[model samples]
Target: MPRRLFIPIIFLTMLSACGGTPASSPSEVASPASTESQLEALATTSLLADIAQHVAGERVHIESILPVGADPHSYQYTPQDVAKVADAKLLILFDDTSYETFLEPLLLTAGGDTEFVFAGAGVGKRADLDLGGFDPHLWLDPNNIIRCVENIREGLTHLDPTGAAVFKSNADAYVAELQSLDAWIVEQVNQIPAERRLLVTNHESLGYFAERYGFTIVGSVLESFSSGASPSAQQMAALIDQIKSSGAPAIFLDAGDNPALAQQIADEMGIRVVADLHLESLTDGAPAGTYIDLMKYNVTQIVTALK
Candidate 1:
């Protein structure tokens, strides 16, 4: 095996032989598992991590694949990440095999029989808008996230059948919270005039939000769904024309995306770019430490900008 893959295989072999995850160098990928069979909690995105943390309660430590404040759309797993995922009991993906393409190697590393779950699988909507792929950002809508929570609850219960009651109870409670959020958003969005509720985001990151909350997606600064994809000159010109015609007040940029292009567009259009939306990841605390907070913060920003 290659050195990167070889190291993890050897490390796991040590875990089996010693009946524990052995001490290794600081550079080595530390398995969250204490024992070979213990579940090492892992989720594919920080936003997903926050959502799952509520359902998990105290059962397991749910670590995110991308660090706080990182953009998952452009994230690539390192060799260390492959090793960490090999020990996971359940891998939570934001989408099916289509989006989150960077995770393919990690899935292969985890082997064929390892359990996995797609939080947005049953979300019941996939558009061909994402550069010949389905847009998988179903969690943008709180209603859709209720479906995600259900899937997560099932996945966790599958791994730890003993905690079925706790998982179900927490999932029920969290889904209620999501419902409350959905209602709260309706009230808040009502403050904005129907015509003013237009979104021009950094990318095609707000389709579900637009669908759920009665906002129109004017256009995106980026032509493609993935933030990693760049816009062509023709695409940029089209987006500028759309924003001009729609009279969209702001270009909502995720905190992690490069702001120069958005800033340029805003300058040319004489509109401001709202760069505070925590669309991809949560922060350490405050503003957007949790999934609910992220939605509230983004909504508040949008309302302030457009209303």
Candidate 2:
């Protein structure tokens, strides 16, 4: 019942319904090349794809399964995505069980000698968090991303040992940028008074961010990492009370998810909704278009609202 397997089943059904023949026989179907002559990396999400692009540089071609603004928590796979997986030389997944529920079957079926690397695997999994599971949003912390970048560099080097030097150089430069970003965030966040450094988000997606930037999460309307779940009336009431008690300036929400509930909570609490946090996805060619920009945007918003 893996969602990824459903794509091939649907494709075969469509072919049968049309009485159409495949151009190539099953045995003759193109498989991923075992030799790393050409490097193709399939990343599970755009955020990871961006980081991989930084590490791979010109040595590899990178493609992402999730589109910009797509929710990784509820992304669905398609036939085209299956072909992308089948054609890649390396497959990089978040692997904190983030994509396992959906991408596991496609990965298993099409991985054929493909170098599969779990980018977050080396960061070690955390299972005791209170978001119904561990929080998989490790990329929110630049320090953690530094670790992820190292994992990516190792994965790329393993696939193309000849270009190992280039991968290392790229990773070093990107890691430096991440370090700078972390320092910059600390400086900017310091502008907010300690009492105002409270974050009340739509979901518990800002745990890593709060932990990194010295902000405390007062509460979330939905007490989970994903926005797919809705808050009950009791939960909503509790969040409103927390916001009022903690004096959180605004309720932050990601772009794609509906902000009605958040807006309602803000209205009842006499606070504002901070629509500037792009927690789950990047913006399309905006100031917050890239992962770096996304962090800058969120920090700016938090400073503006909380300070």
Candidate 3:
């Protein structure tokens, strides 16, 4: 079996060793295990999966459909993925249609038996809300993440009532951590000269991050949030002009997405391209393995590059 399948198998074995019921297959385990009474959660991406893990603690089993290094913007569903979704007792996805175009069809085909939660739903409003649609990357802002964390806690509590206390405790602790991170980010960003607090990125994914951190979004190489959309000549020209005028030091790129366009833009405008911000997905084994680490790494890189 592939490593992905093998890891879950090992995980299941460990669960079994603890007297939890063993799942016959990943798909067969979505329902609550009568023996263990644990809810099975299927998160759309690794970012949400990490958050769900913290919220669920030992009460639920959480799995992510898109593996490490996979671009959520263009991910396609496989049969195995469909099975996993069908098996899940609860599902969590980042709203705003970032990478979930495949989800509706999968859910329709699989039926609506599974409870679904949109983590970004009902979160704080976006500052540069030019997204045309929702920006789905709500977790970019620590305050917004507090909402997402609350939603995850609610969903888990609803699914597994017995785990309500644990979920609440975990959510409270995580929210405190997020609050500390927000304060630290504000402090760190204060070091950057006000004029240098300009962010230009491969896409408009940083609007919330910039809004939260007081950074000005100079412009994006791609005019839209989704990487599927490309910029027209006029947009590109405008971005180049913004780069020149704002004196932004660097452009950030998603590690899994192609950076060629960002590179071209940087080359044309003579700006630096900061590497591997890990915007969409967490790296397999790095400083950005968790959502908190990803945010910390990004903020550190942004502050360093700008300073």
So what's the TM-score on candidate 3?
0.86
lDDT of each candidate versus the true structure: 0.77, 0.75, 0.76
For model 2, what is the alpha-carbon lDDT of residue 128?
A: 34
Indicate the worst ten consecutive residues by lDDT in candidate 1: 1-10
Residue 25 miss distance in model 2 (angstroms): 10
What is the number of backbone collisions in each predicted candidate, taken in the order shown? 0, 0, 1
Off by over 4 Å in 3: 1-34, 96-99, 127-131
Judged by lDDT, which candidate is best?
Answer: 1
In angstroms, give how far residue 49 of model 1 lies from its true place: 1.4
List candidate 2 segments past 4 Å from native: 1-38, 108-111, 124-130
State in Å the error of residue 181, model 3. Answer: 1.1
Candidate 2 residue-wise lDDT, 1-307, digit = tens: 1112111100111222332232334543455443434567788888888888999999898888888888888877777776676665577776544444567655554443355666775553334345666677878888888878887888888778989999999999999999999999999999999999999887788878888788899998788877777878888888878888888888888877678888888888789998757887777787667788888888898899989
Question: What is the descending TM-score order?
Answer: 3, 1, 2
